[model samples]
Target: MQNVYLAATSATPEVDFRFDSHRMSLKGESYPENAQAFYGPLLDAVGSYLAACRGTTIQIDVQLAYFNSSSTKLLMSLFEQFNQAALAGNHVLVNWFHDEEDDTILEFGEEIAEDYPALELLTQALV
Candidate 1:
Protein backbone atom coordinates (compact mmCIF):
# COMPACT_ATOMS: atom_id res chain seq x y z
CA MET A 1 0.00 0.00 0.00
CA GLN A 2 1.06 3.57 -0.67
CA ASN A 3 1.82 6.02 2.16
CA VAL A 4 0.25 9.44 2.76
CA TYR A 5 2.06 12.68 3.45
CA LEU A 6 -0.02 15.87 3.47
CA ALA A 7 1.53 19.21 4.29
CA ALA A 8 -0.38 21.51 6.58
CA THR A 9 -1.61 24.72 5.00
CA SER A 10 -3.91 27.40 6.32
CA ALA A 11 -6.87 25.10 5.86
CA THR A 12 -5.45 21.78 6.96
CA PRO A 13 -3.10 20.05 9.35
CA GLU A 14 0.19 18.39 8.49
CA VAL A 15 -0.36 14.73 7.79
CA ASP A 16 2.80 12.58 7.81
CA PHE A 17 1.98 8.92 7.54
CA ARG A 18 4.52 6.29 6.63
CA PHE A 19 3.39 2.78 5.89
CA ASP A 20 6.75 1.10 5.94
CA SER A 21 7.70 2.69 9.25
CA HIS A 22 4.20 2.60 10.71
CA ARG A 23 4.63 6.16 11.97
CA MET A 24 1.83 8.69 11.62
CA SER A 25 1.95 12.29 12.71
CA LEU A 26 -0.49 15.19 12.44
CA LYS A 27 0.54 18.68 13.42
CA GLY A 28 -0.68 22.28 13.03
CA GLU A 29 -3.98 24.14 13.20
CA SER A 30 -7.06 22.86 11.37
CA TYR A 31 -10.18 24.84 10.71
CA PRO A 32 -10.98 23.90 7.18
CA GLU A 33 -14.26 24.96 5.63
CA ASN A 34 -14.74 21.35 4.50
CA ALA A 35 -13.32 19.14 7.19
CA GLN A 36 -14.59 15.91 5.71
CA ALA A 37 -13.12 16.72 2.36
CA PHE A 38 -9.71 17.16 3.92
CA TYR A 39 -9.81 14.24 6.33
CA GLY A 40 -11.93 11.67 4.58
CA PRO A 41 -9.24 10.60 2.17
CA LEU A 42 -6.63 10.52 4.88
CA LEU A 43 -8.85 8.31 6.99
CA ASP A 44 -9.35 6.07 4.02
CA ALA A 45 -5.61 5.81 3.57
CA VAL A 46 -5.10 4.96 7.21
CA GLY A 47 -7.75 2.29 7.06
CA SER A 48 -6.16 0.77 4.02
CA TYR A 49 -2.74 0.84 5.64
CA LEU A 50 -4.04 -0.82 8.77
CA ALA A 51 -5.82 -3.46 6.80
CA ALA A 52 -2.66 -4.33 4.92
CA CYS A 53 -0.47 -4.12 7.98
CA ARG A 54 -1.81 -7.37 9.37
CA GLY A 55 -1.67 -6.45 13.07
CA THR A 56 1.31 -4.12 12.81
CA THR A 57 1.74 -1.46 15.42
CA ILE A 58 0.33 1.96 14.48
CA GLN A 59 1.83 4.89 16.31
CA ILE A 60 -0.15 8.09 15.89
CA ASP A 61 1.08 11.41 17.14
CA VAL A 62 -1.38 14.30 17.23
CA GLN A 63 -0.14 17.82 17.73
CA LEU A 64 -2.76 20.48 17.21
CA ALA A 65 -2.74 24.18 17.85
CA TYR A 66 -6.43 24.76 17.26
CA PHE A 67 -9.30 23.01 15.55
CA ASN A 68 -12.94 23.74 14.78
CA SER A 69 -15.95 21.62 15.56
CA SER A 70 -15.81 19.77 12.27
CA SER A 71 -12.16 18.97 12.68
CA THR A 72 -12.93 17.89 16.22
CA LYS A 73 -15.40 15.41 14.85
CA LEU A 74 -12.80 14.13 12.45
CA LEU A 75 -10.39 13.69 15.32
CA MET A 76 -12.95 11.67 17.22
CA SER A 77 -13.36 9.42 14.26
CA LEU A 78 -9.62 8.88 14.01
CA PHE A 79 -9.30 8.02 17.67
CA GLU A 80 -12.20 5.66 17.39
CA GLN A 81 -10.31 3.88 14.66
CA PHE A 82 -7.40 3.45 17.02
CA ASN A 83 -9.64 2.07 19.71
CA GLN A 84 -11.24 -0.42 17.36
CA ALA A 85 -7.93 -1.54 15.89
CA ALA A 86 -6.46 -2.09 19.33
CA LEU A 87 -9.52 -3.95 20.55
CA ALA A 88 -9.22 -6.24 17.57
CA GLY A 89 -5.71 -7.26 18.68
CA ASN A 90 -3.79 -4.74 16.63
CA HIS A 91 -1.14 -2.74 18.44
CA VAL A 92 -2.13 0.93 18.35
CA LEU A 93 -0.68 3.78 20.33
CA VAL A 94 -1.82 7.38 20.46
CA ASN A 95 0.21 10.28 21.77
CA TRP A 96 -1.40 13.69 22.13
CA PHE A 97 0.99 16.61 22.55
CA HIS A 98 0.04 20.00 23.89
CA ASP A 99 1.75 23.21 24.84
CA GLU A 100 2.46 23.10 28.54
CA GLU A 101 0.84 26.48 29.06
CA ASP A 102 -2.25 25.56 27.09
CA ASP A 103 -4.74 24.12 29.52
CA THR A 104 -7.38 23.84 26.85
CA ILE A 105 -5.20 21.52 24.84
CA LEU A 106 -4.46 19.42 27.88
CA GLU A 107 -8.13 19.16 28.68
CA PHE A 108 -8.90 18.17 25.13
CA GLY A 109 -6.31 15.42 25.29
CA GLU A 110 -7.76 14.20 28.56
CA GLU A 111 -11.22 14.18 27.09
CA ILE A 112 -10.00 12.15 24.15
CA ALA A 113 -8.29 9.75 26.52
CA GLU A 114 -11.49 9.30 28.45
CA ASP A 115 -13.54 8.78 25.35
CA TYR A 116 -11.30 6.02 24.03
CA PRO A 117 -10.36 3.89 26.96
CA ALA A 118 -9.55 0.89 24.84
CA LEU A 119 -6.50 2.53 23.25
CA GLU A 120 -3.57 3.77 25.25
CA LEU A 121 -3.49 7.57 25.09
CA LEU A 122 -0.48 9.42 26.43
CA THR A 123 -0.08 13.16 27.00
CA GLN A 124 3.11 15.05 26.30
CA ALA A 125 3.68 18.66 27.34
CA LEU A 126 5.55 20.70 24.78
CA VAL A 127 8.39 22.85 25.91
Candidate 2:
Protein backbone atom coordinates (compact mmCIF):
# COMPACT_ATOMS: atom_id res chain seq x y z
CA MET A 1 0.00 0.00 0.00
CA GLN A 2 1.08 3.56 -0.74
CA ASN A 3 1.94 5.99 2.02
CA VAL A 4 -0.65 8.52 3.16
CA TYR A 5 0.28 12.12 3.86
CA LEU A 6 -2.20 14.87 4.66
CA ALA A 7 -1.06 18.41 5.25
CA ALA A 8 -2.26 20.24 8.33
CA THR A 9 -4.84 22.99 8.08
CA SER A 10 -6.10 25.58 10.51
CA ALA A 11 -8.81 23.19 11.63
CA THR A 12 -7.04 19.90 11.09
CA PRO A 13 -3.88 18.05 11.98
CA GLU A 14 -1.21 16.69 9.64
CA VAL A 15 -1.22 12.94 9.01
CA ASP A 16 1.90 11.13 7.87
CA PHE A 17 1.63 7.39 7.37
CA ARG A 18 4.66 5.63 5.92
CA PHE A 19 3.81 2.26 4.47
CA ASP A 20 7.42 1.08 4.13
CA SER A 21 8.45 1.96 7.68
CA HIS A 22 5.15 1.29 9.40
CA ARG A 23 5.52 4.64 11.07
CA MET A 24 2.70 7.13 11.38
CA SER A 25 2.47 10.58 12.91
CA LEU A 26 -0.45 12.92 13.56
CA LYS A 27 0.42 16.43 14.60
CA GLY A 28 -1.04 19.90 15.05
CA GLU A 29 -4.64 20.70 15.97
CA SER A 30 -7.73 18.74 14.93
CA TYR A 31 -11.30 20.04 14.82
CA PRO A 32 -12.35 19.32 11.31
CA GLU A 33 -15.89 20.23 10.25
CA ASN A 34 -16.49 16.70 9.00
CA ALA A 35 -14.56 14.29 11.12
CA GLN A 36 -15.66 11.22 9.18
CA ALA A 37 -14.72 12.76 5.88
CA PHE A 38 -11.27 13.46 7.23
CA TYR A 39 -10.62 10.24 9.13
CA GLY A 40 -12.50 7.51 7.26
CA PRO A 41 -9.98 6.91 4.52
CA LEU A 42 -7.09 7.25 6.93
CA LEU A 43 -8.55 4.58 9.18
CA ASP A 44 -9.24 2.32 6.22
CA ALA A 45 -5.67 2.61 5.03
CA VAL A 46 -4.31 1.86 8.49
CA GLY A 47 -6.59 -1.17 8.87
CA SER A 48 -5.46 -2.47 5.51
CA TYR A 49 -1.82 -1.99 6.43
CA LEU A 50 -2.19 -3.76 9.77
CA ALA A 51 -4.01 -6.62 8.11
CA ALA A 52 -1.10 -7.07 5.75
CA CYS A 53 1.66 -6.67 8.30
CA ARG A 54 3.76 -9.74 9.09
CA GLY A 55 5.07 -9.40 12.65
CA THR A 56 6.49 -5.98 11.85
CA THR A 57 6.74 -3.30 14.48
CA ILE A 58 4.47 -0.33 13.93
CA GLN A 59 5.13 3.02 15.53
CA ILE A 60 2.54 5.75 15.89
CA ASP A 61 3.32 9.19 17.19
CA VAL A 62 0.51 11.56 18.10
CA GLN A 63 1.14 15.23 18.83
CA LEU A 64 -2.13 17.06 18.77
CA ALA A 65 -2.28 20.37 20.58
CA TYR A 66 -6.04 20.25 20.40
CA PHE A 67 -8.76 17.98 19.07
CA ASN A 68 -12.53 18.12 19.29
CA SER A 69 -14.82 15.38 20.65
CA SER A 70 -15.47 14.00 17.20
CA SER A 71 -11.77 13.74 16.61
CA THR A 72 -11.42 12.01 19.95
CA LYS A 73 -13.85 9.29 18.91
CA LEU A 74 -11.96 8.81 15.68
CA LEU A 75 -8.71 8.53 17.60
CA MET A 76 -10.24 5.95 19.92
CA SER A 77 -11.22 3.84 16.95
CA LEU A 78 -7.78 4.21 15.47
CA PHE A 79 -6.21 3.05 18.70
CA GLU A 80 -8.53 0.09 18.75
CA GLN A 81 -6.97 -0.99 15.49
CA PHE A 82 -3.56 -0.69 17.05
CA ASN A 83 -4.66 -2.80 19.99
CA GLN A 84 -5.99 -5.51 17.74
CA ALA A 85 -2.89 -5.49 15.60
CA ALA A 86 -0.63 -5.78 18.62
CA LEU A 87 -2.73 -8.56 20.12
CA ALA A 88 -2.35 -10.43 16.85
CA GLY A 89 1.44 -10.67 17.45
CA ASN A 90 2.77 -7.58 15.66
CA HIS A 91 4.60 -5.15 17.91
CA VAL A 92 2.86 -1.78 18.10
CA LEU A 93 4.15 1.27 19.85
CA VAL A 94 2.14 4.43 20.37
CA ASN A 95 3.90 7.57 21.47
CA TRP A 96 1.39 10.16 22.58
CA PHE A 97 2.83 13.64 22.89
CA HIS A 98 1.21 16.45 24.80
CA ASP A 99 2.18 19.98 25.63
CA GLU A 100 3.70 20.38 29.09
CA GLU A 101 0.96 22.77 30.15
CA ASP A 102 -1.85 20.56 28.88
CA ASP A 103 -2.66 17.99 31.52
CA THR A 104 -5.87 17.15 29.72
CA ILE A 105 -4.06 15.74 26.74
CA LEU A 106 -1.80 13.72 28.98
CA GLU A 107 -4.74 12.37 30.88
CA PHE A 108 -6.44 11.54 27.63
CA GLY A 109 -3.45 9.48 26.61
CA GLU A 110 -3.59 7.66 29.90
CA GLU A 111 -7.20 6.80 29.27
CA ILE A 112 -6.39 5.42 25.88
CA ALA A 113 -3.54 3.43 27.35
CA GLU A 114 -5.89 1.90 29.86
CA ASP A 115 -8.39 1.02 27.18
CA TYR A 116 -5.81 -0.51 24.85
CA PRO A 117 -3.60 -2.26 27.32
CA ALA A 118 -2.32 -4.73 24.78
CA LEU A 119 -0.56 -2.05 22.78
CA GLU A 120 2.58 -0.36 24.01
CA LEU A 121 1.48 3.18 24.84
CA LEU A 122 3.93 5.82 25.94
CA THR A 123 3.01 9.37 26.85
CA GLN A 124 5.62 12.09 26.57
CA ALA A 125 5.65 15.82 27.12
CA LEU A 126 6.29 17.78 23.97
CA VAL A 127 9.56 19.71 23.89
Candidate 3:
Protein backbone atom coordinates (compact mmCIF):
# COMPACT_ATOMS: atom_id res chain seq x y z
CA MET A 1 0.00 0.00 0.00
CA GLN A 2 1.10 3.56 -0.66
CA ASN A 3 2.05 5.86 2.22
CA VAL A 4 -0.21 8.74 3.21
CA TYR A 5 0.94 12.25 4.00
CA LEU A 6 -1.21 15.33 4.54
CA ALA A 7 0.13 18.72 5.46
CA ALA A 8 -1.26 20.49 8.50
CA THR A 9 -3.66 23.35 8.00
CA SER A 10 -5.20 25.85 10.37
CA ALA A 11 -8.18 23.59 10.93
CA THR A 12 -6.53 20.23 10.72
CA PRO A 13 -3.48 18.21 11.74
CA GLU A 14 -0.67 16.70 9.71
CA VAL A 15 -1.07 13.05 8.81
CA ASP A 16 2.02 10.96 8.13
CA PHE A 17 1.37 7.28 7.72
CA ARG A 18 4.32 5.37 6.39
CA PHE A 19 2.98 1.88 5.82
CA ASP A 20 6.33 0.55 4.66
CA SER A 21 7.93 1.65 7.92
CA HIS A 22 4.94 0.70 10.09
CA ARG A 23 4.84 4.17 11.58
CA MET A 24 2.09 6.77 11.66
CA SER A 25 1.76 10.18 13.21
CA LEU A 26 -0.76 12.99 13.56
CA LYS A 27 0.54 16.34 14.70
CA GLY A 28 -0.72 19.88 15.30
CA GLU A 29 -4.29 20.96 15.95
CA SER A 30 -7.38 19.21 14.57
CA TYR A 31 -10.70 20.92 14.28
CA PRO A 32 -11.59 20.15 10.73
CA GLU A 33 -14.87 21.41 9.41
CA ASN A 34 -15.64 17.91 8.21
CA ALA A 35 -14.05 15.49 10.59
CA GLN A 36 -15.30 12.39 8.78
CA ALA A 37 -14.07 13.62 5.45
CA PHE A 38 -10.70 14.29 6.94
CA TYR A 39 -10.30 11.02 8.85
CA GLY A 40 -12.31 8.49 6.86
CA PRO A 41 -9.64 7.59 4.32
CA LEU A 42 -6.98 7.50 6.97
CA LEU A 43 -8.95 5.04 9.05
CA ASP A 44 -9.55 2.96 5.96
CA ALA A 45 -5.87 2.96 5.09
CA VAL A 46 -4.93 1.83 8.55
CA GLY A 47 -7.57 -0.88 8.43
CA SER A 48 -6.19 -2.13 5.15
CA TYR A 49 -2.65 -2.12 6.42
CA LEU A 50 -3.60 -4.00 9.55
CA ALA A 51 -5.54 -6.53 7.57
CA ALA A 52 -2.54 -7.30 5.40
CA CYS A 53 0.12 -7.52 8.08
CA ARG A 54 0.82 -10.09 10.75
CA GLY A 55 3.18 -9.99 13.73
CA THR A 56 4.17 -6.48 12.76
CA THR A 57 4.98 -3.61 15.04
CA ILE A 58 3.09 -0.40 14.34
CA GLN A 59 4.05 2.85 16.02
CA ILE A 60 1.52 5.66 16.19
CA ASP A 61 2.38 9.10 17.47
CA VAL A 62 -0.21 11.76 18.26
CA GLN A 63 0.79 15.28 19.18
CA LEU A 64 -2.21 17.52 19.06
CA ALA A 65 -2.35 20.85 20.80
CA TYR A 66 -6.11 20.95 20.44
CA PHE A 67 -8.98 19.09 18.83
CA ASN A 68 -12.70 19.56 18.59
CA SER A 69 -15.28 17.13 19.91
CA SER A 70 -15.71 15.54 16.51
CA SER A 71 -11.99 15.06 16.18
CA THR A 72 -11.93 13.42 19.57
CA LYS A 73 -14.48 10.83 18.43
CA LEU A 74 -12.57 10.07 15.24
CA LEU A 75 -9.33 9.83 17.15
CA MET A 76 -10.88 7.29 19.45
CA SER A 77 -12.02 5.28 16.46
CA LEU A 78 -8.49 5.32 15.11
CA PHE A 79 -7.18 4.10 18.43
CA GLU A 80 -9.79 1.38 18.47
CA GLN A 81 -8.53 0.13 15.11
CA PHE A 82 -5.01 -0.10 16.52
CA ASN A 83 -6.31 -1.70 19.68
CA GLN A 84 -8.01 -4.38 17.64
CA ALA A 85 -4.85 -4.94 15.64
CA ALA A 86 -2.90 -5.43 18.85
CA LEU A 87 -5.47 -7.90 20.09
CA ALA A 88 -5.01 -9.79 16.85
CA GLY A 89 -1.31 -10.32 17.76
CA ASN A 90 0.33 -7.30 16.19
CA HIS A 91 2.48 -5.02 18.33
CA VAL A 92 0.76 -1.65 18.40
CA LEU A 93 2.40 1.15 20.34
CA VAL A 94 0.80 4.55 20.68
CA ASN A 95 2.81 7.54 21.83
CA TRP A 96 0.72 10.47 22.97
CA PHE A 97 2.73 13.64 23.37
CA HIS A 98 1.54 16.82 25.04
CA ASP A 99 2.96 19.90 26.64
CA GLU A 100 4.15 19.35 30.20
CA GLU A 101 1.60 21.82 31.50
CA ASP A 102 -1.28 20.68 29.33
CA ASP A 103 -3.37 18.77 31.77
CA THR A 104 -6.25 18.47 29.35
CA ILE A 105 -4.22 16.69 26.73
CA LEU A 106 -2.59 14.50 29.36
CA GLU A 107 -5.98 13.52 30.68
CA PHE A 108 -7.18 12.67 27.19
CA GLY A 109 -4.22 10.41 26.69
CA GLU A 110 -4.85 8.78 30.03
CA GLU A 111 -8.44 8.18 29.04
CA ILE A 112 -7.37 6.52 25.82
CA ALA A 113 -4.93 4.31 27.68
CA GLU A 114 -7.63 3.33 30.08
CA ASP A 115 -10.07 2.56 27.30
CA TYR A 116 -7.72 0.59 25.03
CA PRO A 117 -5.93 -1.78 27.34
CA ALA A 118 -4.59 -3.82 24.45
CA LEU A 119 -2.64 -0.88 23.10
CA GLU A 120 0.78 -0.09 24.48
CA LEU A 121 0.25 3.56 25.19
CA LEU A 122 2.98 5.93 26.29
CA THR A 123 1.89 9.37 27.39
CA GLN A 124 4.84 11.71 27.19
CA ALA A 125 5.14 15.24 28.46
CA LEU A 126 7.03 17.60 26.18
CA VAL A 127 9.01 20.48 27.57
lDDT of each: 0.85, 0.93, 0.94
RMSD of each: 1.2, 0.8, 0.6
TM-score of 2: 0.97
Off by over 4 Å in 1: none
Number of clashing pairs per prediction, in order: 0, 0, 0
What lDDT tens digits, residue by residue, belong to model 2 across residues 1-127?
9999989999999999997888999999999999999999999999999999878899999999999999999999999998999999999999999998899999999999999998899999977
Residue 68 C-alpha lDDT in model 1: 89
Top of the candidates by TM-score: 3
Model 3 C-alpha lDDT per residue in residues 95-122, reported as the tens digit of each score = 9999999999999999999999999999
Q: List the residue pairs that clash in candidate 2.
A: none
lDDT of 1 by residue, 61-116 (tens): 99998888898889888888777777777787889999989998889888888988
How high a TM-score does candidate 3 get? 0.98
Task: Provide the TM-score for each candidate, comma-separated.
Answer: 0.93, 0.97, 0.98
Error of 1 at 30 (Å): 0.4
